[model samples]
Target chain A: MIQLLRTLGHLTVDGVWQVGFATRFLFAMLRHSGPSFARFSLTIRELYFSGVLSLVIIVVSGAFVGMVLGLQGYDTLQRFGSESALGSIVALSLLRELGPVVAALLFASRAGSAVTAEIGLMKATEQLTAMDMMAVNPIARVVAPRFWGGVLSMPLLAAIFSTVGVIGGWFIGVVVIGVDNGTFWSQMANSVDFREDVVNGVVKSFVFGWAVSLIAVFQGYDCTPTAEGVSRAITKTVVYSSLMVLALDFILTSFMYIGK
Target chain B: MNRAILDLWVGAFVALGFAALMFLAMQVANVSEEGTRGETITLRARFEDIGGLKVKAPVKSAGVVVGRVAAIRFDPQTYQAEVEMKVSAAYPFPKDTIASILTSGLLGEQYVGLAAGADSEMLKDGDRIEMTQSALVLEKLIGQFLFNKAAEGGSK
Candidate 1:
């Protein structure tokens, strides 16, 4: 067990170094590619898949989140004789943290794994080799598109999640639960700042997007030429990317508060 | 090919509709926009803490929205939060009105709730609300309760 722990520690150190190397490599690729007009077009295609295709899940999940928050918040506030603050609570939580984080996790699980699998299969089948033989950079052609797509799509999806979630909370708090409309909206307005909490949420989404996509592409690209290897790559990408999103969220939140 | 094209168009329209709905909902829940109406007067309240407060949060009197919070800032000198609220012109507030930071539920958001005083003098725009209460943070309250219980147990 002691030997195992030592090996695990060594692996973790190596993993961190590998991540640092990949980050620098990706940055270099971005710089060398210049405007990357081809990648930009590919990014739009990816946005349609990752952002537009995920709308139903985002809305449905957002509604339930909002409704649950409203019901629980209202019940609790009743004890303190301040039941009207439900809107602010719902809005602030959704905009600042919940919307982006949850949406990104869901996106990573559904799409990030798929992206990894697709790329891993291509690698296993030697399609990437063919591209290399043809004098095309696979990272520039494939990875860059997915990376930009995830970054762009994440914020759009998060915005949808936040808006739908707030509306869902309003439906439950106001129409069903009988909280006054004026009070609900007023509390939401009084407690939230558009430029601060909301913008912060959007920025976090963009970061999460880049991180998830890069993790997926890297894992996929590194897969051995075997079916099992492709499968493992897909699974690892989803799990690792989701964990990265949460860890990054904590770091970002600490930075936002402590830096200012 | 035509069927596939038609399906794509239908999907695009649905997405557009969803986006529009979301935009409308935001407009409805927007407190800042509502405050822009002609019959509203803005006031400021200072608190030690404004926990999980958002810009669009409501200002209430007896569970009714008399206004919304317009802005929030931290005072460098006092280290207190200065909250600017826009009250409806129809609701008359006395100069001595008490403003308190209150929770909606046990784990709910915090907002400023106003309790009107009997004084005849009305509050004006930019006037300060002197009787302001800070947020009752649950963690602090829980810690205090636990400490008291432990102390009592030790004494006994």
Candidate 2:
């Protein structure tokens, strides 16, 4: 009983400590990321590495999800004799929820994990310490660029994902399913509110981007600098970022749909 | 050399992303055309119940959209919901046109539908459409149906 209580207390203390450490580290990273063109190249490189590389998967998955939504939406709407509304259903689902959530999950597993693994490997190799010893601020040189890159790319990736998904949905619903093209497009255009769906969805993805990137960079920066530690950080980046995106999505969606 | 390549890719990536967003805002959201559209005439109508009617819901005439609901409010004196809408200047209606709030489908958004009348003078900006119909509330209809059935049973 005493041992169990002690373990519980230890876990609580460690959790609190980790939260504090992560916040401080995030602030440091943000402080380093200022309006300076000095490290612009570094930021650009990181953006390319993260954003451009992630595009293929984001686009492919978005299209697939959209096609699936179109098929399922058509099937369901057919039951109500309202197959004309397939476009609106598919678009709303993609714009409001699935597009951002799925893209963020893929990003966490792909670019976020890559970021964590790369930074963890650097730490394990003592490169970060070497840079620190050589009169360099490692956070400014190493972490800030990746942080900004991830943040900037996230919303963009999500937009592309949703756009392609809408197109894919159109193709599937109109071409293969033989739904009235005019009705499908017109219903969606007439119904989906810009402020309520698209803008809010962008805002959600932006917040998710910031959160997932922060988690990735923080995990890497504080890794134990061992092989096991690096691997664990990579796994944690994927799992933690995915959970954070979903949790934040739920909170934001509730605020958007009800709190307003 | 590699930096330029990276910069180009990043710029292109950002551009594509912004383009997608622009499509959503302009085409899908139809946000940009809200109030700034060159020629539009504002109109208002009163209803007994708005019934899920919202701002920006399309105003249609003869199954075609002519405008959108601009604002909605309730009047204390008459206790009716006042809806302000903007119709396209090109599709102006007569002074005696009848406006009705209608739902697109069984479960869909509510919109204002205008039926033209024989009045020669067309409605201009800030016109009040006197002839108006309120929305059909499904719940109220069902409740009345059930009540009538119970009353018939009682009589029998």
Best by TM-score: 2
Candidate 2 lDDT (Cα, whole model)?
Answer: 0.88
- As for candidate 2, its clashing pairs are none
Docking class of predicted structure 1: incorrect
Overlapping backbone residue pairs in candidate 1 total 26
**lDDT string, candidate 2, B1-156, tens digits:** 477787888899999999999877776666754432568888999999989998878888888777888899999999999999988887768999999999987988898999999999989889899999999999998999999999999999
Q: Write the per-residue lDDT of candidate 2 for residues A1-260, one digit (tens) a residue.
A: 99999999999999899999999998888788873237588888888888999999999999999999988898898998989888789889989999889999999988999999999999999999999999888899889999989998999999999999998999999998899888887778766788889988999999999999999999998998999999999988998899899999999999998784
- Supply DockQ values for each candidate: 0.12, 0.68
Number of clashes recorded per candidate? 26, 0
Task: Report the C-alpha displacement of residue B102, candidate 1, in angstroms.
Answer: 15
Provide the RMSD of all predictions against the true structure, rounded to 1 decimal: 8.1, 3.6
TM-score of each model, paired residue for residue: 0.68, 0.87
TM-score of 1: 0.68
Model 1, range A1-260, lDDT digits (tens) per residue?
99999999999998998888778867865764433454355555666666667778887998999899889988998888788888888888888888889998988987788788888999989999999899888877776776676666777778788888888999999999999999888778756665567668778988998888788777888777699999998888988998999999999989865565
Q: Report lDDT (CA) for all predictions.
A: 0.79, 0.88
Off by over 4 Å in 1: A32-39, B1-156
For model 1 the local lDDT of residue B30 reads 50
